[model samples]
Target: MHAPDRPASYAHPARLILILSLAPTVGLGIGRFAYALVLPDMRDTLAWSYSAAGFMNTINAAGYLAGALFASRMIRRFGLAASVRWGTLACVLSLALCAITGNFYVLSFARLLAGVGAAAGFVGGGALAATIAQSRPERANFLLSLFYAGPGIGILASGLAAPFVLQGFGPGSWWIVWWAMTALAVVMTIPVLLAPFHARAALTETTAVKFAVAPVVIYLTGYFLFGAGYIAYMTFMIAYIRDAGGGAAAQSAFWSLIGVSAFATPWVWRRVLALDRGGLATTIILGVNAIGAAMPIFGHSVWLLATSALVFGVAFFAVVGSTTAFVRFNYPPQAWPTAIAAMTISFGIGQTLGPIVVGAITDALGSLSFALNVSAAMLALGAVLSAFQRKVRSF
Candidate 1:
């Protein structure tokens, strides 16, 4: 296949891919995931019950799962550009709804819609980018890493930006944060809209044949655990830090540090992936995650919290990048997106379960220590699973 003619600066294919990918990161990260950071404020402002807040998260996760399952079909029917445009528009409108409505039910509905939009945009955009970089699979891996890195950047941006917005503007500023994020989503669409079409037509027959492999199933299981463990910490870390007697600044800084580490992950993991044994390298990464999760339980100091963020940030995205690379190495190109979607669905399932399970433990036990312990256990199990991954040619 001849390379698509490159766009001028603003609409280059790589730039479009990055922009489309960023829309989901902002939607999922700031619109959906950042809810955890602002939950205390939202609950107090709205006088929402804990169950109501929990249900909102559940709805968001359910929507994400639905979108992931349907994304491939949506892209096949609508084409990548249309899917990206509409999906991003949905996310922007959903966040706008969130900014306008104070009704808990309405806000929850908007969040659910946002999740659906984010998943479709992310999966479709990622697949488009991967297809464009088919000749340079390693570059594809790097672009996918950039795709996943969007959420971390969003989280970091929200964490730092929200506190400042609240401090300068006073209470009920969470809505303002959503409004700003919505604008960014709209801005993100411009680059994507201007870029040349990069997605090739799908090969249904070849894809169907490639989806039958057993290694894919095992890979998905491992990814599910990764989601469970990672989300447990990400969702609660800000609250956990505050509850541990750290001030708001400390909490924000901790998340920012995680973001910084996450931003540098692709560069760092290029070295990790260069190691001789791919499976063993992944196991070591998972083990680092286990230790990171356990850090808060063992120490309450601000330094310890910072250490945890660093450990988690560095290892988390690297593991995800490694998983995608592993899948691509083991499967044919046409099947990559489906394999990724399957793994993502499993991961989303685990993520949905994580917050509820951790919330229950915190409610009953009056601390997050038990939840952290469970996270550690899950990561350790993931490490064990990584060891068993059939050694494909390392990326």
Candidate 2:
């Protein structure tokens, strides 16, 4: 048994931290990550061109970028609770609107709204978690890991849920899934609202911290490459599998495998960080992702797909954990948010362009294999960047 004054392992403080940390994951993962899973279905139903679908993703990333830039001020002015509630409400409403209509313009608008809401939620939640973890470094690191795990969980949940929901309800039932997701979002918001807001000085700082900006910039570049490869894979993996003659069960299983692997990321990276060579670890993870991206190009076999998913899953979460931890260790406490925001914005930019670039590549080559290869190349570039980043400690 643990000491009573030690916050009781996994009790109030731990549970609260976990819950709040999960808010961004649900907000971004469900609202954003799930969008890709459903896109193929939506495209078929709505007769959307590839460019149109890609544009939707770009719009969302744009909103997320804007929200990240402004969210700190919003939280400072309104407090964490109000910001969370407002963001949740926006997400719920946007998803609801998406369910009710198939108009391309309206769908784009809804996605934008959802993106903005998700961004706000992510920024606020991350800031809050960082604040709480400041004094309790171990707990803080755990909470940070938990925050990123939300998306992996969301991806797994949606990947499993989307196919069954679509099959059971028949055509045009994508709206039903959206509505259900909206309901889930609203329900999840209740717990968040009830939880006490533990304000910390680390949460409110908007100024640049002590780290040299150059290395941070290089890190952002690598981060951008990561976003491109990861998003492209996530956005199209299910469809790619299905297109290659895999059954619905196979597709679902593939995503589940990815999710399960992703779920272990925080635990794995925690050990990696203990080595105190986060830069090298990051390079290795990015290289792994590049290899994963190349797997599908070899063949469309089910075994290959499964292997690719697992590799991608492990690499994806590990990279996120390593990069975020890198920021925490390298930067001063006050500048953490700005550094994170800067990195996230670079990610958003990559994500914003990735889908469209993939779509264009697919159009040109008439196969996802080419697109996957392009993504692999980008990951390779990121790996190089990661290695180069080690020389400069300031950024």
Candidate 3:
């Protein structure tokens, strides 16, 4: 008799993706975006100026860039699972520190540390997911999508939980949110611990692929601007809502909608991602996101905010995915790592500049709405740049 076939669950890669995804969920969802939820309270309780608040995210973005630079080396040294495990641990510790301190400098340091940890976890988790995709080539896209969707799960959970906490514990206890996030991070770390790790052979040959900025300059520029524009909106959104007289209930609904929309992004954009028109895919998505980012400034109706959240949520993560797709279509497999790294570094630089600049604008104008309009203008310019890109051809 033939040996019994492996059970579907045993053979399927979903469980592995599920486990790996927790890294992004915590790293991005709580470590990064949760600041938006916590910011209003932090401002009121801590008596922080808008510029000071913006500087916190600016330092965090700088840390994220610094961490990204070192993440590849860490993955090589510690291996993927260990890197992810330790990174998650560091992130939780950072969150815990944020809870314990009310000092401005100390809290800024904590956000910066959290950014570093989040970047490490994000990089390691993505590499692990790529390894799994190689092993299960047929389901590669779906599995990767599931892994990327982890942030959406984190966002959803935070959006749902934060309002309740704020309502129950009151706004003065913003530190409670950080502690709660730390607890969730502890739970999320379990899957990373349980996931199996296998060593792979080292790459023996280096392929010489010449990278030229002129050929894809427009696309790269567009992506960089996208990094700059999207972050400003995300960093200040909660405070903006509160300024507009929105209550916790409205905030919960708006943020949760974004999370829910994010969960459905892979399916929505699968066809668009297949496009190989140099920067067309990215151009379209960025345009949509820019509209979402600008909507609140146009009007403050409940329907407008909800629509903005849904559209913004749907396109936010997928914008990064578009750049990955661009690299895949334009470069050989061996060149992917270098191209992606270059693009990521550019994106990180843009993010580092975005928050502080927006903050300065807000401080000058005394209007978050004006800052958001500036963000939308940047995104629009990015779309224009992306529109000029053509598929790279042999010289």
Mind giving the per-residue lDDT tens digits that candidate 1 earns over 228-294? 7877677677767767776667867887887778778767676665443546667777788878888
TM-scores, in order shown? 0.87, 0.89, 0.90
The whole-model lDDT of each prediction reads 0.69, 0.72, 0.77
Query: Against the hidden true structure, what lDDT does model 1 obtain?
Result: 0.69
Which residue pairs does candidate 1 place in steric collision? none
Model 2 agreement with the true structure over 1-395: per-residue lDDT tens digits = 11111222323555666677556656676787777667778888988766677788878877777777777667667765566667766877887888898888898888888878877777666655555555465555666676667667666776678777877887778898888777777777777777766543323454444435665577788888888877777777777887888765887788777777877776766666434454776788888888888899899877888898888887777676666677676665555566666667778788888888887777777787778788888988998887766533543
Regions of candidate 3 where Cα sits further than 4 Å from its true position: 1-11, 136-139, 201-215, 332-337, 390-395
List the candidates ranked by TM-score, beginning with the highest.
Answer: 3, 2, 1
Which residue pairs does candidate 2 place in steric collision?
A: 212-394, 212-395, 216-395
